[model samples]
Target: MLWLVPLFLLALRAVQAWSPTDSYAPGNVSCADDISLVREASGLSPNETAWLEKRDAYTKQALREFLDGATANFSNSSLVDSLWSADKIPRVAMAFSGGGYRAMLSGAGMISAFDNRTNGSTEHGLGGLLQGATYLAGLSGGNWLVGSLAWNNWTSVQHVIDTRGKDDELWDISNSIVNPGGINILSSASRWDQISDAVEAKQDAGFNTSLADVWGRALAYNFFPTLSKGGDGYTWSTLRDADVFKNGEMPFPISVADGRYPGTQIVDLNSTLFEFNPFEMGSWDPSLNAFTDVKYLGTNARNGTPVTKGQCVAGFDNTGFVIGTSSTLFNQFLLQLNTTSVSSFLKGIIGDFLKDLSEDYDDIAIYNPNPFRETEFVESNYTKGIVNSENLFLVDGGEDGENIPFVPLIQKERDVDVIFALDNSADTDEYWPAGLSLISTYERQFGAQGKDIAFPYVPDFDTFINEGLNQKPVFFGCDASNTTGLSYTPPLIVYMPNNRQSYNSNTSTFKMSYSSSQRMKMFQNGFEAVTRNNLTDDSSFRGCVACAVLRRKQESQNMTLPQECAKCFQDYCWNGKISNKTAKVSTIENYSGSISFITDSASADAASSTAAASSSGTSTSKKNAAASLPSSNSLKWYVAFASLLGMAIGLM
Candidate 1:
């Protein structure tokens, strides 16, 4: 009788509702007769160059506030102002790594700490750094965080936090993607119906669809619930049309994907890295150094010209699809359709369609009418079967092992001085990063695929963990003199790895869901990680960040590093030590970070334990580390269910 309620509601709703409409299908657009959409990837596009001019003015106040807050401990802080007044402003970029929802929630907290709008951020955290930043890059789950902010007109993290589980609000991950009803049974059925219809509509329009499409649609329900058809009409290219973006109130956003050929099983480090920004979608890698108007993506082109005279296609760069392309790793989720509790009707639609696609490469996103087909400039340095093919296949950006989205920031044309690399990769069995992504990017610099790109030198994985590089924040490329054989020096890397914090944030990367309390704890841990527990770990952490941002500019201006800045560099920057010892496990499955809030029963237990440890003469740092054991009282039932689900997923 209880099970009959869902079937009855679903049947009644199917009769009452029409399929949700979305901009999933490609449509014709007026291309202004002779306008060419595709162009050579020679340098920064004119659109980006012009946008930077607008951003320069906008960042002035933000940078000022940031610098003021950063250099509070310095005696000769006036020198910093003089340097800035002399047109030596720092150019900062932040890249977020991919690790499913863990990255999204943790990255959200990092952004919140860097954001001026988050309460207490300006006073006690690294607020205004996000505003001062010139660019933001993300891939996979990180792209979810970036897209959520950009699509919502650059909304604050506080806004997202405030509206967690309200009806139609985003971040309602209680039911996971497989069953996204949360507390409402009706919304779950309606959502699955919408996802099935959206994918079918794309297929009916002669486009190739895959599990990535299904994955993206489910992602939208959690990230864009308030928008029409869950933001189905939203296209990534349309971000430029937003007033806030046009006014340069937000940093330029970039999402990344990796090109794969038909039947390719693995994407290696040499694979072409494609980036999607508001203006263009392309790669700067030598294999296919070309870009096309992202809005006109579905149009056929040859040698940078339209294949059909005076005709072009639009609405092909659907926001969900573009993000889906970057996060194709999640296509594995859809592959588990038979195991999920999804209605047989919706499962049939997805299962039937996926059976036709390559089971070995279900992660691929098919871009038919390949925009670069027969393009001579792209063919000149072609790799494998890309140029002559009529379809383009792209997969997860992190598939190549460069999970942190640093490729875009290191491009010489961007002139970025430093990048804050927020790593949340699941590189270990226990799900923690060990600087492998940085190593991959560094090794790419010596290959032909690297071409004009330069990345900071990083040591092997053994040294990364043995030297504690993967746990706390460390600076790479602190000295330009260490890097050679590149046309230009790479931006300094501010590596901030997701280590044990106020919570054991190393939940499995495939853990698809989080209770509200668990999610908030992850966010709090991320915020604490970035702020170094609001500088409790080191009062000089903020000053060190400022020094990193100003490192290149100060060198270029022939000015010496400030005394305080030099000391900060000595303390936080890696000193080029190598280790022969084998790497040990990096994940500590306990709360070891400073406890700020006690929202759940786990937190309450942590607080009680910390009190006991304090009386027993435990050290302060150890107490903080041992206090975080995360679980929610309100969600104890789900926690038990999720534990079983997690174990099952692990076995599978």
Candidate 2:
């Protein structure tokens, strides 16, 4: 008889892909190299800037093709010139937020709408946006989207869907991370040992191991498929070698994390923000603004040379560990590690380890021989940690609520002209982007000690929700003159919040696994939100995207604005307004309702009732209650249980 998986709540794998052929082999991607380089303390790496030069050429060509399709029947030669010109071309970026799998799949859907690779995405869709984009960044679960596509040589989202379930590869979450599902038929007992052994080996080799390492191995089973590709190992740095990434065929991938000091849940605006690309692991944030050779992570170096730990360590920044570092919110599962489901004897063994981990490494990555330890630029707030053990602890990117990886994208050095930030955050009790991410980012950009980055104006959360700005698309920094305080014109931000007209894509971030059908609906809902249901709701959606692209170029060239673009700016730009008072979702026929999309549609009346139920009790108890109150930024347990039971896992 087939085994029926036990019902459990919490603990989720954000991105899923792949498995190998009949038998599992060693690994595919190669790790480590013979080269060494000088680590720079300031500015973009020479390597990345050189790569961006080549990448810009690819995107410009792609954008010219997109513009031809968008403006085929138009008569404006000047507009076409700016759109198609090598110099006047707009630099575009796409950012994904972290909300577990919801962030991953919803992000995938948004990309599908922007990508030419998806069927019908180009015609009357935003498909060409991906090709036009130079940078792709993700936070928490969002990195799952970036990593999955990059690992496959930058394959299309459709391809990820097509290959899944054919042999239980690429999104077979039927087996929880706690259980082995792919080609490895080992029972949960064997798999647990396998994970523990791997981590132990790393520790045995004189490297420090933490819960993040264990979490990485658990999450990698679904997304990291190279274990059987026959090589030393697969890692995030290995992507620099893939032909697609190396040839500049794919947008540069950035993974984000916040440096967290021990014994604190508070992630202040001044906290060190770190980013990981294939070439380096560092931060653009003013505090310790520097990058280290990601390939030489475990090496003991003095100003970038091997010293104390003479032998450099390869595979230290494991691809899975790096991705897991950005999404450790699910490490709450460790609390469930000692549950009775396994065995009393094994439970006792792990329960001991859990106690020790709770003291210091609570769901965070531990980077030893921290590249910034002895560097001159190391700020005092960050110096203490390195002083103790030369360790750097990094946590989930969204810990400070800047769920979209905007730090790197906004770096003036990158010269990004526009950022299409995908906000799939569970900002409300119903799970939608409430513009909190934007608010946090804005405050930090202009806040005390945060003077380096430039950000456009974002209204209070009250204004964001009350004005219906969170329910649809809006643009910030539409005019270059507005950011007069910055050294350079900040990139225009096209904020796209999640909405539900088709699929209820606002699933809780804590709900761990999802079935193929539910996952596909998320992809569809994401596509609808980005296209506004293919102009079925707002006909101006595509035009607005084009206008955001054209805004900067228009200012730079002092070109007469197109009438359509002028209207787009007037409609989407956030006028300087502050409102501490909150608002409701736009009830305009185009938008479904102000209620949580996760709540079923009983009618407008039922939405209010459900919202009430949420505040009176928990979301699980709100099916019969009135409307729910807006929740705090932290993940809600009620949403978690309700989501786990209602979809994916059929607990009932």
Query: Candidate 2 — which residues are off by over 4 angstroms?
Result: 1-38, 73-77, 83-86, 180-186, 229-232, 308-310, 331-357, 377-389, 583-652
- Model 1, range 117-234, lDDT digits (tens) per residue? 8988876789989999999999999998998788666777897677666775567776666556645757665866777777767767766666667767667767766666766656
TM-scores, one per candidate:
0.83, 0.79
Task: For residues 609-628, write the lDDT of model 2, one tens digit per residue.
Answer: 33333323311110111111
For lDDT, the strongest prediction is: 1
Which of the numbered candidates is closest to the native, going by highest TM-score?
A: 1
Give the Cα-based TM-score of candidate 2 against the true structure.
Answer: 0.79
lDDT of each: 0.72, 0.65
Q: Candidate 2's C-alpha lDDT?
A: 0.65
